[model samples]
Every structure is written in C-alpha cells, then in structure tokens.
Target: MEMSRALDISAAGMDAQSMRLRVIAENLANQDTTGSAPGADPYRRKTITFAETMDRGTGQPEVQVKQIGQDMSDFTTRYEPSHPAADAQGYVKLPNVNNFVELMDMREAERSYSANLNVMQVTRSMLTRTIDLLR
Candidate 1:
C-alpha cells in the first residue's frame, strides 16, 4: 500500500502543478490587458498557493491548491500618450505580470509536474511487477 500511497501523492502533486500552470498561462495571456475604460485598474497577476494536507483515508500528505490569490504589488506605468488607458499625465498602467518572471515560474512548474508524473509511473510499474511475481 505504500507504493499506492506514493502514486496517489505524486498524482495529487501533478494535479496541483497543472492548476498552477494554468493560472500562470492566464497571467501571461493577459499581460497587456489594461483597463477597458479610462481611470480603471489594469489586469493584476494571479497567484497560486499550494498546501499539503493529510488524506484521512490514506493518512498521506497530499498537495492541494490552497488559494488562488491576487498579487498586491503595484502595477507598472509607462508613458504611452496615445493609449486609451493613459492617465492625465499620459502614463499608462501596465499589468504587473513580467514575462521573465512568468517564464521562470512556468519552467519550475513544468519540472515539478514532470517529476511527479515520473514518480507515479515508477510506482505503477513497481506495483505491476509485484503482482506479476506473486502470480
């Protein structure tokens, strides 16, 4: 049952990372999205938080999405006089999502997800072998 637990844990981790990746993609997609009308807030980056919780039935610590929160950091301002969302000073509010940072986060999430998937696959193979040996 330990192997099964390992597989379950890894599967849960993969699921959590997948969700994180999705949120990151959304942030990237909306990076240039400014306020529809003037004097409105620009798009903010969404944040994903993960938590490890005990699965009561399995007594295993599994990863879960704790929160999908908003980044409170200040938005960047660019002097774009022609932009519709420009302020009185001809400064436009830009989303807080930075391409470099988002790319790095995406890479990390992808690695974690791959590792978890590898773990689950290995566990499944081991279980299969054990069953074959018994028979």
Candidate 2:
C-alpha cells in the first residue's frame, strides 16, 4: 500500500512538472512576439503554480497544478519606426518573456520531472522484487 502511494505521489509530481515544462516552452517560443496592431499589448509570459492536495483514497499528499497565470510585469519597448506595431512615438511593445529566464525555468522543470520519474522507477522495481519474492 505504501509503495502504491509513493507511485501515485510521484506520478502526480511528474504531471505537474510536465505542465510546467510546456508553459516554459510556450514562453520561449513567444519571447520575441510583438503586438500586431499599434499600441496593442504583446503576448504575456505564462506561469504555472503547483499545490499539494491530499488524495482521498490513499490519504497521501499529491502535487497538482493550482493555476496557470500570466506574468503581470511591464513589457519592454523598443524604437522601431518601420514596425507595424509601433506606437505614435515609434516604440514597439515586446513580450515580457525573457529567453534567459525561460531557459532556466525549463532546466528546473526538467530536473524535477526527472526526479519524479526516478522515484516511480525505483518504486516499481521494489514492487516487482516483492512480488517475485512472494512467488
């Protein structure tokens, strides 16, 4: 029962990290995205939040994505007179997503996902051995 609970917890963690990775990827992809119209806002960076909840059946804490929210930080502006999205002052609004930050976040999420996967693999191996011994 304990082993099953551990597996469940690890799986939940992996799921949460998977969603986080996806968000990071999206942010990276839109790092340079700008608004299509003048004075319009560009794409905003997405953020994921995780929350711990008790599993009713297993009575164990499991991680889940609480919400996916947008970054409220101010967008950077650049002078580009020829750009269609340029405002009256020839300033183009760029996305708030930072490449460096997105890369770092991707690395962290990858590490977390790997850790959860390792836990699941180890738990499965232990369960397999237990069954073999019983047989």
> Could you say which candidate leads in lDDT?
2
Candidate 1 lDDT for residue 7: 84
Q: Model 1 clash pairs? A: none
> Per-residue alpha-carbon lDDT of model 2 for 1-135, expressed as tens digits?
899999999999999999998999888888888989998999999999999999998889999999999999999999998999999999999999988898888899899999999999999999999999999
Off by over 4 Å in 1: none
lDDT tens readout by residue for model 1, 55-120: 998998999999999999999889988889888888888999999999999999999999999998
lDDT of 2 at 49: 92
Candidate 1 positional error at 56, Å: 1.6
Of the candidates shown, which would achieve the greatest TM-score relative to the real structure? 2
lDDT for 126 (candidate 1): 93
**Can you tell me which runs of candidate 2 are displaced by over 4 Å?**
none
